[model samples]
Every structure is written in C-alpha cells, then in structure tokens.
Target: MNDKKLELECLRLISDGSGIGYINGIATFVTGLLPGETGVVAVYEAKKKWQRARLQSIIKSSPERIIPPCTVFSGCGGCQLQHMTYEETLIWKQRWVEDALSRIGKLKVTVKPTIGMEHPWRYRNKARLHRESTGKLGYFKERSKTLIHFEDCLLISERMNRWIRLTEEFLTKGYPEIHTLTFRENDKGEGLLLLEGVPTKALSEEENPDLFEALSREGLRSVWGSDSEGNLVLIWGEEMFNQTILDMPFDVSPLSFLQVNSKQTDVLYAHVLAEAALTRAETVWDLYSGIGTLTLALAREAKKVTGIEENPYAVEDAIQNAAKNNAIGHVEFLKGKVESRMMKIEEQPDVVVLDPPRAGMHPEVVKRLLELKPQRIIYVSCDPGTLGRDLRLLSQGGYRVESVQPVDMFPWTQHVETVVCLNRKHS
Candidate 1:
C-alpha cells in the first residue's frame, strides 16, 4: 500500500481510544494521537468515507496528555487511554455515555459525572495472557496477532505478576502444548490458575510435582485445565475458587464470568441495589444472572427473587451460592436461555434487573419486558453503543429513562460500566 502523508488535527477520541480527525469531510483515525493534538500521519489504508493512518510526528499536543508509565503501553492491547490524565479520562467517559444516549438513542437526559477510584492502579483482579509458540506469555499487539511481552503489567496485583513469571519460566522449559493462561485473584490476593490447552505431561502430584508445589507455595489455591473436549477439570487443589463481594461470599468456577475489577464491582452493585429500592412485598427478576451475585443481593429486600441464566455451570454455581449465602429459600435459579425462560415465569415482578452481555439484550427479551411491563427496570450494561440501542427500544415501548450512572470499572481503558434506571410511564 502506498502511504500518503498528511498533517491532521485530532478533534476528539473515538470509542476505541483512537483519535479521529476530519480531512475533506472524511474521518481519519490515527492511533497514539490525542484530541487537541496535531500530528503528521501516514495514511496507509483509505476508504471512501474513512482512512486508517499511522502517527508520524506530533506537531501539537493536548494539555491532558501525559507520558504513559507502562513499558508496553504503546503496543499492548490491555489498556488504552493511558496517555491521558485519569481525571480527564473520567470526564471523557461521561461524555461518551452522554453522546451515545443523545446521538444513538435520541434521548436528551443528564448523565452524572463518572465515578472514579481514588487509587486507580493495581485494581484489576483478573488477567488473561496468550502463550506464543515458544512458550512465552503476553498480550497481543493492538488489532494484531503479534505477541508483545511486558516486564510488569500495572493493572494486576504484584502477587499475580510473580505467579506469571514463575509459570512462564516453568512452561518455557518444554511445554509447547499450553497456549493460554488465565489468572483470577480474590480480594485477599489469593490466585487461581486456569490453563486452556492440553498438556503433554500429566500435571499431577505423582507426575510433575514441582509446578504445583511452586505455585501452591506462592499463594495459588487451585489449578484448573481444559480437557480435549473443552470441559474444565480440576487438576489439583480445591474444586472452587472463593471470592467475597460486598460482604457476600461466592464460589466461582473457571467457566463462570465475574467482573474483572474487584473494587469497582462493589461500587457498581451498590448503585444497582440503591436504584432497585426493593421492599419486602415486592417481587424482582434478575435476567442473565451469572452465579447469582445480583440475584442474591436483591433477595435481601424483595419478597421473592428469580434469577434466569442459560449457562448450566453458572446456574450450578448460583444455586450453591444461594445456599452459601443462606438465601436459598427466597431466591430461585432457573437454568435456560433468558429469552425462553422469561415466558414461563408465572409471578408478576414489581422490578426487573438486566445485566446482559456486551452484545446487549436480544430483541425478544426487550419485547418481553415491554409485555411484562414492570413498574421499575434497572439495567446494568458494559457497552454504551448497545445500551443506547436497547434504551431507544425500551423508551419507545413506554419506559422513561430515569437516570444513567457511569462507573469507571476499567480505568486507563476505553471501556466503562453503566447502570440505568427506568420507570413505566403509567407508573
């Protein structure tokens, strides 16, 4: 591809943290360029309406831009917006939510300023690293398969960093079979390892004792691996990984999903509970409830709470979690697709809580909600673009947008978590 060089001035940042500049009515996207910055870029790929360019030289810079401290910040896909100040990033996240609501949903509503952490670094409790062919472990380059190793990832705790080093050193010896490593940590810094490839050697106490011994010595409570059939089996240690969220205990399996940021999950769930405002007489439904975290919380106030989930593993965990939390009597866990299980729910719900996946709600789910017509709906969303589209549908179906709160769950990244509350117009 022939490169065309052009001097561009970035007007704003896009959803992916890339700077967008307009030239001759066509948008040009250049990585590593911040808003209010002018840089000469090499336009490599040009389309009829847009172009992708590479930053060459910065002729001007934004006041909020700062030098990122991460060693692999320029190439690694783990974190974005590291070059911008944290305070400014929070402001932009709020604006992003406002933009999505107005431009996509066509709703003119006030969005509260983003809630940020006092100390944002080292807050992540989970990390997934890809293994290269030679057994080296690291994250991939942005939008590329090229693996880039990091000396130290600032997102996770120091304890996890040590575990990664130990595991990498052990695997580099000859374990070409393992291709991915996932680390999950609890609030106490206890770690769990999940290896996602078949091992040439059996990882048992009798066969390879050193690997487990070293990891166990370093505070790893368990090790799990996927079989050839893709089912997770406990290779060693405890069967379940334990985590405490908002004073409630949870048993998480490798296949289950939990929030990556431990501290912000508390903040996010507290906001959800506050917005729910459930009473003893009210009934609530938690759709897409994973491991029953929010469902159990709602059970404390609601007369009865039902959690609908499709993943059988997550449903099993949620059932056990309800028992562990002593809310088994008030909470019910249904194992099936939410869009299908919702049709069978006999009890009328006073409030409905939705924490759907990043792809957002299915159209049928939205239509069902419109039919059910719950008095109050509290939606927890991770993607703003999808949230806006669903909100537009719900608003058209007779729900008024009450409030939208954006939480900085993943700081130094382009992602955010938002909680929205809506009320039926008749109510």
Candidate 2:
C-alpha cells in the first residue's frame, strides 16, 4: 500500500540457502539473510536487466542467525558466514558443494560433512595487508579499488595482530608509500611482516631511522624491493625460525606459498595421505607440490616420491625440506610443468597427488594424467568450479569418483578446499 512496502516486495529472497538473495529473478548476495526470513532490501543501483539491493530491515530473522563475534564482520569482508551459526554454516557449505557437483559437474558422488576446524577464529597464519597513500592499511573492498582500513583483524593470528598495531604506528611516522605488507607466523608463533616496496621520494633515510629499529622491536622482518625484480632478503633476522627449510624445520619466506592455516594443514595432509593409500613398493608423484608439504608426507609411506613444481625456489625449498626431514633419499624434486615433465618418468607412480592452483589443472595436464592412469588420483582443489570441470574430464577417462571430502582450511569465507579420491575403473 505504501512506497516502503512496495519496495520490499520487489526484492523477495526466493532461496537464502547459499548466502545468495534472489530478487526479481536476479541473484543478490547478502551477508545476514537466512532462508524463510523476510527483509526490506534497499536498491542502490538499478539497470533495465537487473537490480542490486542491500538489506534495509529484517522483518523476520531466521533461526539460523547468530551473534557475530567480530565487530567488523560485515564491513571487513574477511569472513562471509560469521553472522550465521557455526553448525548452520557447515550444513550450508556441505549443501553448496553437493549442489555444485550435481548441477555443475553432473556427478552423483556423496558429499561428506565439511571437516571443520577445532579453533576457527584467528586461524590464519598469514595476512597480506595492502597500503594506500592515505596511510590506510587493510584489504581492498569487494569489487572496488578502495581500501578499508582496520586496526585489528579477528582472522589473523595474535602475533600478526600485534605486528599490525605496530605497523600502524610505523606508518604514522610520515614514511614513504608502502604497497603491500605480508605477515607470516612461524612455528614458534613469532610474527614477521615483510614490507615490500621501493623507497619513494617521500621516504628518506634520515626521516625514518625508526623504521628498522621499530621492526626489530616488533620482531618483524623487513624485505625491500620492487614487486617485479627483488629478492626476499631477510633483514635483522634469520631466514626461518621454526618450520623446516631445505630438510630442517624453519621459517618460510614471504614469497613462498605455504598453507595460510598452519594448524589445519596437518589434518589436510593426513587426509591426502589416506586418500593416496600408498604402499612401500609403489612410487608416488606429487604434482604442484609447493615446498614439498605433500611430497614429504608421501615419502613416509611410499617407496619413493617425486615432486614437480614450476617455481625453482619452491623446488629448491622442497629439496631442502626433504633432506632436513631425512626423507631426501626417498624423494626427488623436478622443476617444470607437470604435463611436460611427467612424460620423462620411467615408471608410473601408484598414486598421484594433484594440488593445483585455484585455476585447477590445465586441459593438457588432465589429458596426460588420464593417459598415465595411475592407480589412485588425489585431487586437492581450492576452487570448486574448476575442480568439477576437471573431475568430469577424469571421469571421461574411466576414473570413477570414490570419495569427496571438503576441508574448511579457510573459515568465514565462501572458498572451500576439497580432496577427491578417484580410482581407475579397472583397478
């Protein structure tokens, strides 16, 4: 009857199952909306084809709604499901994976309950903070180029939070522009912030003598260089403090691609090992094995393990890690693309563990793997869309999906890491 009531009906949430709000045939994703709940959405921008709306008022709240722990839950864009209860979040995520597989991949495999973290909050061991000219340090807004500043992040480790506070103080000293700051947590829980950038004209040696001293006080390591051509030189500290390096446990470099969540990585690795079902006489191939995390694990079970990676630094680190762990004799590192280098292997592995990037495996890589036809293929994917596509191709080559388990390596976000076990039809 009134203008406000008329606007409410225009945006009806047909299904709020996957954090997506369907309004007038267009999917409008909102944070707090739940299924069967009614809300007044404010339309900010409208086009002839579709409309975008924000929740104005919750006329009815779903039972799934819960109190958000973080004060900046909505604005931070760090955690997507913080508003929803943890139990509800897990249920929805499982359903999301099942729906994606059935609808997108056309597969009928069972989707197991999501493997949740014991401690969900502050699980991230790494945080990449972007710096703007305005002294604001935080993540970029979703779909926007602007940055949203924050003092502390609930998702980062406690040591990283301390570093963020100290870095904020350092930035207030009228230093030059800093493009990005990557924070890493060692096994000892010590935090290191790698500040990357060239010394702009605004930054002078005499102006900020406290930069290095402050970093030392905060126990933060500094690495200076342009984004394109600069080495990660450890200033004021050793290269690694806790985790293994080359073959011994040590700290990883800022440029290295270690798992963001340190605690859950052990669990994820165990799952991959179980899926592989390695034997002592069989060889194993770890594809895209960064820093030999999976390669080292595989060597413990298999007779021998060969890891292939494109990055020479990662391959070198993997070699060092293997030697340090006393697994070097059983493991070897090859630096190259998997599709091209896999052909050089004289013996086919009994198991192949694929942990590709978010883009998933290339078509040629998939073709080669299917041709090799290993006894078991363990696909660890970060993106469900590409994972599903690749799974379909593997299925075409007679590899049946045996089991699919979703691991919540990253909590609060829509991103899910899944490990699928596939076996050859005849094997």
RMSD of each: 1.4, 3.7
lDDT tens string, model 2, 173-234? 55555678777776556666566764333333355667656655666544333344545544
The total number of steric clashes, by the backbone 3 Å criterion, in model 2 comes to: 14
lDDT of each: 0.90, 0.73
Give the candidate number with the greatest lDDT: 1
On residues 1-427, what C-alpha lDDT tens digit does candidate 1 reach at each position? 6777789999998888889998788999988899899999998888999999999999998999999999899888678889999999999899899999999999989999999999999998888888987778898787788898987999988889989998888877876778888999998778998888753235676666887788888899988887666688787788878889889999998878888888889999999999999878889999999999989988988899999999888999999999999997889999999999999887788999999999999999999999999999999999999999999999999999999999999999999899999999974
Off by over 4 Å in 2: 1-18, 21-28, 45-51, 199-226, 244-251
How do all models score by TM-score?
0.97, 0.89
Model 1, poorest ten-residue lDDT window? Answer: 198-207
Worst 10 residues of 2 by lDDT: 6-15
